[model samples]
Every structure is written in C-alpha cells, then in structure tokens.
Target chain A: MPTKAMFLMIKQMLQRPFTNPFPVKHAPKDVTSLVEKIQKGEVKIHPPVPVPEGFRGKLHYDPERCIGCRLCITVCPANAMEWIPELRKIRHYVSRCMFCALCVDVCPGKKFPGEEKAVKALSMSDEFLIADYDKYSDNLIEEPPEAKEKGI
Target chain B: MAKTTYYIPVGPIHPALKEPIRVEAEVEGEKIVKVDVKRGFAHRGIEYMGMKRNAIQTLYLSERICGICSISHPYAFVIGSEKALGIEAPPRAQYIRTIIAELERIHSHILWLGVIAHEIGFDPLLFWTWKGREKVLDILEAITGNRINYAMYMIGGVRRDLKESHIKALRDMITYYWEFTEHMKEVFLSDPVYKARTRGVAQLSKEMALKLNVVGPTARAAGIRMDVRQDIPYDAYADMDVKAIVPQDIVGEARGDAYDITMVRLYEIEQSLDIIEFCLDNLPEGKILAIPNYVALLNKIKKTEGEAIGAHEAPRGEVIHYLKYDGTRDGPAVWKVIAPSYNNINSWAPLLLGAEVADIPVVVAYIDPCMCCNDRVAVVEDSSGRLLDYSYLHKKAVEKTRKLEKELGVRR
Candidate 1:
C-alpha cells in the first residue's frame, strides 16, 4: 500500500464527512409534520449550493410585454409551450420544459438601437423548484390576471 | 459426450448492465462461445421528432440524443446546418465551442473511468475517481449554465460567451484537474489489482479493431490512429495542433484491452485540460453567437435546401449528423444521427467471444456503450433464415417492461 493514499484516507476519517448530512441534520421528530413546520415558519431550511449564473430553471413570462408572436411556441423542442389564440397568450407546460432556455434566447424582447420598445416578452427565472404532480395546473402556465391584449 | 451449453440473457434490464442492451451469450461451461446483442430498448426517436420541428428547434432534440455525449449531437447538427446555410461561426465562437467540447471529454472520460472501476469491483477507486469528476461538472455547470445537456450550441455558434470571469475559472479548473491527474496516477496506475483485472483481458488485435471499424479511444487503444478531431478538425481544432493519444504512447504497447482503454481515457482527460488551456490563452475576442437574431437564423435555414454531413469527436468516438433540408419544410427533410456507440457496438461480438462469463460487464464497458444512441439505430439481422424486424424488437422490449412491472408488484 502506498503511504500517501493511506495517510490521506486516515486524514479523511479524522475529518468531518465529505458529504452533506442533508436530512440527518434537519429531520424533525415527527416526519409528516415537517411540511407543516416549514409552512408555519417553525423550521428553518438549508438551501443547496447556490446555482450558477444564467442557470435555466423555471419559466417567467410577462403578459403585458408579450406580443403573442408565437416565437416561443415555434422554437420549444419539447412541445412545452402552446399558443392560445383565444387568450392572446402562450400556454407553457413546466413539466414538459427541458430547461434548454432556447425560448429565452429567441424571444425578441431586448431593446436595440432606434427601437421604441422591447417586443420579445418571455424569459427564464432562477426559481427551479417547479415540479408538481398535475401537468395541467395553475403553476405551469402564465395566465396573468390583467394585460389581456387582443390577437394581432 | 457433448459439452453442456447454457444460454444466458443478461438484459433488457439487469443490475450488471447500466443500459438496456440484451446480450444473449452462448456459454459452454464458463467460457462464452458466441454472444448476440439486441438493442432498441431506449429508442425515444428524437431524430424522427427533429423532422417535425424547425431547424432551431431540432438543435434541442439533437442535444438530448444521449445525456453523456449530449453536446456531440448538437455540435454535429449545428455544423451541418451551418454548412447547409453557407455561413460560418466567428473565430471566438469556434474557440468557445472547442473549450466546452474538450471540457465535456474530460468529464466523460472521468465518468467512464469511475464506471469501469465499479464494474471491476474497485469501489474505492470508483468513489475516488468520481470525486475528481465533480470538479469538471462544477466548471461545466458554471460555464454553460447546465451540467449535462448544456444547450451551449446555437445553430451558427454557441449560445453563451466565455467571459473574463469564465477565463479565470477555466485557468483555475485546468490547474485543479492537472493536479487531480497526478493523484489518479498514484492511486489507480500503481495498483496491481487494477492492472491484473484490466491488462491482457479481452485483448482485441489491431487487425480485428480495424475490421470492426471502431472509433475514438477504443480504436486508439488498438494501435489504430483514428480520431475525428485529427481527421475532420471542426471548431478550433482546425486551427490548433492536437496530438492523438494511443495506448502505445502511454503503456509502451497496444494491448487493446480494458487497461489500454483506461490508459487512453486517462491520457485524454489530461489532453482535454491542455486543449482548454490552449483555447483560453489563444481565444479570439468577439461576439459569442454568429446569427444576430433567432428568426434570421431560421430564415437562413428556411431558405437553404441542401445536404451536409457534420462530424464531431465525442468522448466515446465519432458522432456524425447528416441533414437534408427541403426549402419548403419547417425542419430537415431527413435528419440522420449516427452516434459513436452505433459503430463501436459491432466490435462486441468479437470482443466477447472466447471470454469468460465473468468478464462480460468489463468487456461491455470497454466499448463504453451508450445504448440510448444505439437504440435509435435499427439493425435488421438475419440468423440463418430468421429475420428480426422493428416490430419484433418492440414486442420484446414491451414484454420485458411489463414483466418488470409485474415483478415489482409481486415484490411489493
């Protein structure tokens, strides 16, 4: 056996665990009440390592700014977004989204020189915890209360 | 007296096999006489889906072909699409792509090493190697914004720019990985048990490798100097000098077994670090993306109707994407993606023959077979007069899934 690896292994044994003690550090006495505690602000949460910059996570769409151009629907690979002509907005399926952020890049919302306003309305948010059981739920789509623009 | 023969079906799903490759091995006692391989379990048919979407949309589909070599498909697809459009990605974009691709190779090789070590029952080495691999993944996540399906490649160029911060990160990453390589050498290379389990076992002759038409490290391990980066030289590889790492270069001779593959892969991880460093040092400063707007890119693809083949050197081997676009269609009229594992799968027949039943996992892992890519490739094989079609394979896969579900229920 090499002296170096042995020493290193020994050092590792003496030190704290390399892995994060996630649940072991924070598990409440009663397991089912953990959710209730979190909701009631009785339990503090430990966040994961901070996400990187430009990390494609949850979808965030601005209805007022959106032109309903259908560029996002046209470009989504996973068929995650659908153009609803009646609503004059796009319907996004968060469950189906690949988090590719192609729609974010393609959206023509950013202002250019001599341009009056930003037209491309869709963008991505850093909120990644968006998974849910129901695929067609209120959380998935961006059905804003106001800003109902007529179809151009 | 006739020798007793037993046929063992390893998987459509087995604990030993990582992917859904069914290996029907004809074993006489402990020695494998002949092995028949059947795929088509993980075929999601992204290529067929690519045809339904626009060219820009298809790039995302290409990225999902195999999670391991995720960038390779999009790299080839974009190159082919660019060739078809008669536009070139700026020098800055090419160099950035080169950086990402090399980084991808680093992670892939390290991942493969960990898997191979696990297969050989070297659990300590597996954990140790994977620990080293996490650094690469962190850098990748930092650079491209995602870990696996990077979505870094745009049609004409890369989506993200390698900023000053990214350059500093790359430099630090190179330094960290270079030191990690030294530790890896001390741990894995000097171990006699690793050498015994790997060396001389499942030795593929140079002639057999040539006959099998293997690519990537497997080909290099067999003394065949075949590398797509050296031959085709897409991205910044065309501009920079790349030295192909063969088994002989490291271990003094080509054994073309598990050990040589391991050596070739380990060496490749070092080479990738060198390439990344080179790219950062000589990186051209400009815009990251070639196409100004998304529709402008779509318009170019919409107008152009031509055929072009793009090849990328994935960590496993060569990935070729052939795109045929008819001007009228929203997407490519025909999109054919041939991943490296598709070519490398053919060598398994010769490699597995005469090997002991125990060596099956190592032999299979030697090819670093990505069945998700292979499943897309439909092979019609005729055994004597019996022909196996898509329907037959489909039925077999469905039956296996149902059986598994039933087995789960019974266990519950």
Candidate 2:
C-alpha cells in the first residue's frame, strides 16, 4: 500500500494540478480586451477540464424544426418550460432549468415517411458558462435560428 | 466539588454534522449518560411534489430525493411504477439498469468513505479516496449525460443506451476500483489509528439492529443477514444470487462498530464491481424501452389503478417507495417513501447513550446518514413556540380539508 502511495506521489508531482486555482484563470478588467488579446495571440487562455461526449449542459433549441407538440412541457420536472398559447411555442427559463435533459428526451424531432431528422428541436449544448446577471436575459432565451436572416 | 453531569446539544447545527439533526447528550466524565435524537429539520416535501406531477415527470423528480444515492429513489420509483402499470422493461434494459445502479453504488460508497474519513480528521485519506472516486464519476457522466440527477431512468426502461465506448469505460473503471478498494482496506481496516478511533465506537448488536428495523449497510454492519436485493429481488437482481455482506463472515465476531462499517463498505465496492462486470458480459441486445413514447406511457399510468411497493439496496441502505394510482390521474394518487436513514436513526439514541463525547461524529458518520432522504414530513410548531403533537396536527389537517370543501361549495 505504501508503495502505491509512493507511485501516486511521484505521478502527481510530475502531473499538472488537477484543480483550478482559487480565482480561476485569466481574469481581466474587461472581456472585450481579453478577447482582443487572445485574437492577437498575445495571451493564451488555459482551457478548463474536458467534458465527456454528450454532456448535458445548457439548453439549445431549434425553433424552426419545433412542432410545438408540448411533450417537453409535459415531462419537464422543473416546470422550466412556459407555454405561449398565442405563439404556440414554449419559452424556457434557463434559471429554472435543472439541466435534467428530460425535455430534450421528449422532443418530437421532425420525421418524414422514411428517414428521421438527425437532431431534435431541443437539445443540450456544451455551453455551460451560462451564469448571467439577468435571469430573463435575451442571451438565455432560445431565440429563433432565423432571427438573424429575418431580423425578428 | 466535581460536577455530576453536563448537558450538551450537538446539533441542529454543529461542526461535525454535515446535515441538520439535533442530538442532545448528557455526559458525566466523558461518558454519555443519556441521549435524545431529534430529526425532522430537513424535509422538502419531495413526495408531495411528485404526486402533483405526471408519472414520467414524477419518476425524474424522485431521483432528486438524495444527493449521494441519486439512482436509488428513481430505482424504487420506476420499479413500483412498472409494477402498478404491469409493464416490464426489456431484458437488456434490466441489465442496463443494474449496471447504472451498481456504478452509483460504487461511487456512493467511496463518497461515504471519504466523508467518514474527513469526520475523523484524516484529511489525506479523504483526499485520496475522493481522488480515486473521480474515476467512477467520470464513467457515470460518460454513460448517463450528467454526474448526478442522471435523469436516465424512465418508467418502464432507461433513457440512454449504453454505447460501446461507455462499456469500455465501465470495464476500465471496474478494474480501477478493484485495486482502489485493496488500498482502502489497508488504510481503513488494518491501520492502527483508524481502528482505535472506530473499533468500539457506535457498537450495535444483532438483536438491537433487528428490533430497530434498520435497513441497508447499517444493519449489515450489525451482522443482520438481510438485504433488499437478497430478500425481495427485482429486475436483474431477480436472477443473481446477492447475499448480504455481514461483518461476522469476514471477522470472527460481529462488533458492529464503525470500523466494521468501513470494512463492509469497502468490500461492497468490490461486490458492486462484480455486479457491473457480470452485467456487461451478459448484456442482451434489444429495445431499451418497453413504452418509448412518453405520452403513451403517461396515458397508461392514468388508466392504471393499482398500488405497489418497491425496495432497493442503496449504498447507504434500502430506499422503499410506495405508489398508488386511482385510474384518474397520470401521477401517483399517494406517494410515500421510507429512506433507510429513518430506520437507521432509531439506533442513534441507544448507541450514543453510553458512548464517549468524542465518539459523536464517529457514530453519526457511521450511519452514512442522509437527512434530506429521511425527513419527508416537517415538524409542526405553533406560533407560541409550543410543540404540536401528532393528534393535534391530524385534527388541523382534517379541518383544512373541510374548510376547502366549504369554500369551494363542494360537500363530502
């Protein structure tokens, strides 16, 4: 047992630290300035720990493909999906989402006679850095994918 | 003149306690003379919340009942729900469910080992054990989307299929834990300091364990030959011969102390690894879900009228869920849960009665207690700060029901 401990000691000594430092990496006065510095290759921001494939993080919605079946609403344990009867769509409150991914499971992705759509309308993206000052911020909302083209 | 005795209240809040529970102990010269354990500080009304939702939603909600054994509540809930609805998960699905549950058990047991070590002020051991535990958690995340609150278990089957990559990860993890547990035995079982702190601490007897009705590993530590998997088998467990792990079988006599508990948990980790390996080798190929359609599943639950009890051997102990469907609502008409900590808590007062003051944390941590899992019902206190007894609360409940009926112009 002590031999194992010795091996672990040497191994950890050579390995990079497993945990983040107290303040974390690369804090600056402004995010815009930090982005500029990174773009110019003057600074290198360290990457965080690698998440596994198919990680459940923030909610991502494909409104164009959405059929509005409301099955996601029925199975969402957190009540994070709000039904808009007039719009016939669901509005998500990311602050209330527990990231359980149950809504994504119940999503009725587009299907033709022979082939199924590759992706569901609602899915879990890898973007987990979703902390924001506004709980109802525009960034947190699942804006329509066509908003840029149609200027909605 | 020397004082005869001193009264000390260890909780609702204390340094040693990780959760909210009150234990009042009277001590005379470091020897506890009497003890009283007062719980009901951590109830969240999760069962009540579950009953208000549809069956599938309630299934995921039950997974949040305990933070450590996240899979245990949902296992029991799905088992009970499937029984009430008369739906059987595919054979492959049953094996997959067993795999995930065993993975959770390995992780939970390691977590408890770290917690108990930290309680005893062995910080290095805590760090090392948790570091080793990260392997299992990583595999769990790879297989089930998230590390905790997996949201992976459906009513009749599991949500995700175990891919080839996932099985490879699990097999590697099983090997890692097999070696990890051996080192744990050296550190926790045979170490002189660990044994000194825990050898005679929280000692319980076989008769006392049976009388208290404790379930899970806490009862097993006292050499009780009972386990939910072994007694009332379900799913893949129905086929496997899972015998309970008792301390007396390993050691000559059953001291049923904290040291024995450490040993029991460490061995159980190997047992879980065996279960996982068995599942991986025997995993059948077929559809993973009996009723893959969520809408169809909820509709079936609405039309079903039945009641069933499901029990599972969680890392801490047995978690049992009672569900009833009245053929009216999609969710359970009534939902009741009996977490192992509720029954294991019965031994606290008796064990702490004669224990030394220093042994408080030892006794408390030995149970691997989950306050949130146990305290499903809240304690009622009146405005004047008087404790309301059971009958008074029952009368108040009835009055409220009658008041609601009158207000709504509905008569019973």
What digit string (tens of lDDT, one per residue) describes model 1 on residues B1-412? 9888898988899987777878899999999997898778898878888898898889988887886888888889989988877779999999999888888899888888889888888776677778778887888899888888998888778888887888898898899999998877666666777788888777888999888888889999998888888888888998777878997877688888888888888888898988888888889988877786988778778888898999999999999889998888657989998888988989888878999877877888888889888677556566786768888889999999889989888553
Residue pairs in collision within model 1: A108-A120, A109-A120
**In model 2, where do residues sit more than 4 Å from their true spots?**
A1-41, A111-119, A143-152, B2-4, B381-412
Cα lDDT tens digits for candidate 2, B1-412: 9679888987898876778999888899999998889999888888889889888778878888887788999999999888888999999899999999999988889999988888888776777788888888888888887888788888888989999999888888888888889888876887777778998889988898889888788888889888888999988888788888988888877778898888888889988888888889989999999999888888898898999998888888888899999999999999999999999888888888878878888888888889989998876788999989989989999999999999999966
Residue B353 displacement in candidate 1 (angstroms): 1.8
Which pairs clash (backbone N, Cα, C closer than 3 Å) in model 2?
B216-B317
Window of ten residues with lowest summed lDDT in model 1 chain B? B374-383
Candidate maximizing TM-score? 1
Name the candidate that leads on lDDT.
2
The TM-scores, chain A only, for the candidates as listed are 0.77, 0.71
Q: Go through the candidates in order and give the C-alpha RMSD of each one to the true structure.
A: 5.3, 5.3
* Model 1 whole-model lDDT (C-alpha atoms): 0.82
* DockQ of candidate 2 (2 decimals): 0.45
